[model samples]
Target: MRKAMIVWGGWPGHDPDLCASMIRGWLKAEGFEVRIETTTAAFADPAIFDLSLIIPIYTMSKIEKAEALNLCAAVSSGVGLAGHHGGMCDAFRDSVDYQFLCGGQWVAHPGNIIDYRVDLTRPDDPIMKGLKSFEHRSEQYYMHVDPANEVLATTTFTGEHAPWIEGVVMPVVWKKRYGTGRVFYSSLGHRAYELDVPEIRTLMTRGMLWAARE
Candidate 1:
């Protein structure tokens, strides 16, 4: 069976474990073997690079290069990588190379928790097929992006968060090709209950499969 490995842990504020559990169930239902490890130490193994897909559920702080490179090597060789919100973007903020690989970095999401709408820029993409623009009440991330991302979906702000920036458009969902592999990321996940809803889960799960190089 193909494997889905989840590395979750950081500030509990992101509800890493809860989100990890939700992802595990989603992967299981899809018939993939799941592994959950709550530390950066899990990245210590070169063998993990052999796994089919990797899900980083943690909002990283400090990361070790040896472990981080293992991931880069794996994805460069076609192992898939995917994550949502701070778990992937905010992760390793101190490391520019990691940010380059993930394709974005979290800046200030003004007003903290706010209600926003996410629009599907490419409705036919498997990750966003059948979904429409939907409103959610949670933390809306404002990210600084890398140039290479192929944005599949976007969300607009109406000058509420940062009044200085009017009608700001943000890439809520995107994919990038790293060497022979594919990388997928969504900025939607902030709270655990977001997954309990069907539309959001559908967007996320399909993105997972897409990132798995499937």
Candidate 2:
């Protein structure tokens, strides 16, 4: 079985613990030998780089230089990385290396917890296969993303909440490579329950599997 690890803990608003549990259950069902940790110290383990995949759910937290370097080295060496929302992209804000590895960083969420539509940008991609555009009533993330990301889904700002960005399109889902490793991220899932939406759930699970590089 493929080996995977989920390290979660940080901002309570994001419910990192609950979200980690959900991801752990899903990964187990997918035949992975999954381990769960509630500390960033897990990233310091030299063996972390040996795992098939790593999911970091801690948001707005600090990562030591050693931990950050370990993670970056692991991903660059072909260990896959996957995460959603602020948990991944918004994590370790002080570490530019981490943000670079993620291919994006959460900048702001205008009109927090508002109704929005997610458009499928690359329906032909396996990670987005059979998925259609869907509606979501949650924070529509405005992120600073890497130009090289292979974007798969997007959303347009209505300007109702933030007029300056009216009709501006932002990437909602994207996949990119950190060296030989596959990196997947979705701006959805501001809260655990938001993942209950079928399309959101499917997209995340598939993205995880794809990132595992199995």
Candidate 3:
């Protein structure tokens, strides 16, 4: 069985525990030997490098130097990493290395919790195959993303909330490589219940499986 670790804990607003539980169920159902840890210290373990995938659901938290370095090294060595929303993108705000690995960082969410559309950009990609544009009533993330990312889905700003960004298209889902490792992220799921949306749930699950190098 493939080995995977989900290290969660940071802001309680994202409901890290609930997110981890949902992911745990998915990973186990897919035949992975999954472990869940509530601390960033788990990233420092040498064994982390041996895992198939790492999911960090930590938002706006601090990561020690050693732990950050170890986590980066593991992903660089081809251990896949996958996550979503502020938990992954906004995590370790001071750690540029982590942000570099993630390919993006959450900067702002215009209109906070409101309805928006997530348009599929690469429907042919396996991770996005069979998925269609969907409507979501949540935070519309405006991120500073790495140009190198292979964007798979996007959202356009209507300017209703933020005038300057009106009509601007922003990436909502993307995948990239950090060294030989696969990295996948989505700017969705501000609330745990959002994962219940069929399309959102399917996309996240498929993205994690893809990042696992499966």
Candidate 4:
């Protein structure tokens, strides 16, 4: 069976545990041998680094250097990495190594929790194949994105407080190639309910499958 391990915990504000459980259930239904290791020690062992994918949902903490290096090597060797919002972008704000691996950092979000629209850009992408434009009432992330990342979804600043920021499109969802490893990240998921959204769930499912070193 396909095997995967997710290391999650930290910053309950992001609800990492709850989000991890949801992703676990989806992967389980998809026939993967899923495991959860909610400990910092797990991130450092080389033995645990050979899974089809490695998911880190922690935010703003230093993982053991050994473990962090192992994960970086795994991704460079073609293991896929996937996460959303702070789980990936806000994870290690001070660690350039972490930012390099994640492709970008979360900068400023104008409307933290305002009505926003996520426009599907990569219509041909498998993750967006059946998706139409989606709308949600949540924090619309405005990231200083990596030019290397291929954006799949985006939102424009149409709010009154965003005029100056207008025309500066923000990426809502993106996919990129890191060395031999594939990476996927979405600016959604500020809350558990965001993950519960059918559109978000669908996007994440396809993204996970695509990023799993297939």
Give candidate 1's whole-model lDDT: 0.84
Give the C-alpha lDDT of model 2. 0.93
lDDT of 3 by residue, 106-183 (tens): 999988998999999999999999889988899999999999999999999999988999999999999999999999
Clashes of 3: 0
Off by over 4 Å in 1: none
Off by over 4 Å in 4: none
**Candidates sorted by TM-score, descending order?**
3, 2, 1, 4
- Give the alpha-carbon lDDT of every model: 0.84, 0.93, 0.94, 0.82
Name the runs in model 3 displaced over 4 angstroms.
none
Per residue, candidate 2 scores C-alpha lDDT tens digits across 51-151 of 99999999999999899999999999999999999999999999998999999999899989899999999999999999999888989999999999999
RMSD of each: 1.2, 0.8, 0.7, 1.5
lDDT of 1 by residue, 25-90 (tens): 999999899999988877767777678889987785777887787778888888888998899898
Give the best candidate by lDDT. Answer: 3
Write down the TM-score for model 4: 0.94
TM-score for all predictions?
0.96, 0.98, 0.98, 0.94
